[model samples]
Target: MGQQTRAHLTGRKIYGCGRCGTHLTTVEALLSKRFTGKFGQATLFYSVVNVLEGPPEDRRMTTGLHTVVDLRCLKCETYLGWKYIKSFEQSEKYKENCFLLERALLQTIEPGLELEGAEDPISREGNDSSTASNLQEEDDDDDDDDGDDEDE
Candidate 1:
């Protein structure tokens, strides 16, 4: 899921992996209502990633009934949360797109360059803030020199 939007949720971009600053998915695709258990207050949503479910030993997981899939960071391989293959409702079967939100976070689209595995995005002013600040300071110094010349 790249970008999702709901009629009610306008510009509500909920993200995960705030520390690593990785983009997982949005809240628009939430299927089930938010619940709490092994994970904190979490909800399920749709994901294009291969959502699988099983214990470590039984890795041959499938989207069978009552199966749980692990949601990982696409970049750092960090554990984000799990996904329910089926809906919590007994009647519903494998029809719902349910991905868990273990550590769901809110992210903003920073107006800057996008780099993979980057904690902080480079600002729009320039990729090198140090160089930009130095250039600004030099400009200030030039203004001071102009003032001094006028006085002379």
Candidate 2:
């Protein structure tokens, strides 16, 4: 008999937020339920960054997903989201899947960018009172040099 081999079942893998590291389990679960009935019926590719599962193995080991929407900040190389291959029917052809969350649902999953008052602490604090106060003071001092502007 030919050697028997085990076949692995392929399924969706969930991810967490890049900035906050918040798990997207609930979001992925909900999307899985929603898409279970809609596979291969529509063109559903959308923009999203590929968050790799682990560190790069070599110099050429870029996150090898289908479509990488954005290259996140180098200081914090967090993957945002990505489109995944759903199925392969031909040698060079494959089906893909993506999540289409409602504005509310997207906000729930990635609230900081998708909703008001959902920004991260660093982003919020960057424009908060202390920083704003310093900028205002700088503007006030700049206004005192009226002759400097005319000379230029």
Candidate 3:
């Protein structure tokens, strides 16, 4: 086996997957914390890493109609949140191309701390279907609530 490539963020504070503790984004990428997600409070970020974007879906939110793609942790396939692809409302265009990470699904990783499961190169490959299935079961319940509230 070869050395695995890891994308670790260098910051005073880092946000990672709550389940897997894989680095997602840092405080520098944070845009706002007034957004809401399926689980409740969400945060807007300018960018994120180590995430997979699901298929885009049109959902009518309190702000307006938006096309968003759900984001999942690459290491654990945990449902983190979604990214706004297209915003129909002119006033809401600022959210386009922004990532929304659910606070409920994030864990704060302090500086100098090694990420959990960072050494397991197999997990980064994302080939474990069984593990993903189990971790996603609870998140599936939130899918029915498509009409999410607006982002402040």
Candidate 4:
């Protein structure tokens, strides 16, 4: 298979693959958070990125029967959710072409935001603070020596 290029999403609130951190979608594309999936809580999105759709299948959901294709992360190939291809019931027709992402399987990515199972910058800084303070104290001692020379 040829190398697949992953799509990058830009926004204040971006959702990514929980395991690989591959960009998925943004808050602006989110439609609703009141959906359920195999894992439990799920969310609906108007569009998504960096995903691959599997074969479509007819599944009977709470509302009605829907033709959906399972979606996987394009980078890691992890199953994230599914996309509605068609709805049998008229009341659920609005969900067609929409994507349903499982919340438990997704990670929210933001600037300076610490991701779960990832290294935290704040804790790393804390570990090096003592060394940084020691260097500052040495600089202060040199300043004091300058004052002593002036007195002489």
Residue-wise C-alpha lDDT for candidate 2, range 1-152, written one tens digit per residue? 56333221112422233244333333223322112111111112232332233322211112222321222222245433333433233321222344322211111233233222233333444433332233234334323321311100
lDDT scores in order: 0.40, 0.27, 0.75, 0.69
Q: How close is candidate 4 to the true structure, as a TM-score?
A: 0.73
lDDT of 4 by residue, 1-120 (tens): 999777666776677776677778877786666567887666678899889999999998878789999999887788989999999999788789999887667766663343334322
Clashes within 3 Å, all models in order = 1, 1, 0, 0
TM-score to true structure, per model:
0.46, 0.22, 0.74, 0.73
Task: Give the Cα error of residue 14 in candidate 1, in Å.
Answer: 4.5
The best candidate in terms of TM-score: 3
Global Cα lDDT for candidate 3: 0.75
Clashing pairs in 4: none
Reference-based lDDT, residue 73, model 2: 21
Which residue runs of candidate 1 sit more than 4 Å off their true CA positions?
A: 1-14, 48-65, 86-89, 92-96, 104-152
Worst 10 residues of 3 by lDDT: 130-139
TM value for model 2: 0.22
Worst 10 residues of 1 by lDDT: 143-152
| Model 3 residue 132 distance off true place after TM-score fit, in angstroms | 22
lDDT of 1 by residue, 30-141 (tens): 4543344243434445652422243522122232235555665554455656665544445544334456554333233232314243344233244434322332343333
Best by lDDT: 3
Selected candidate, larger lDDT, 3 vs 4: 3
Q: After superposing candidate 4, which stretches have Cα over 4 Å from the reference?
A: 111-152
Error of 2 at 47 (Å): 8.3
Q: Order candidates by lDDT, high to low.
A: 3, 4, 1, 2
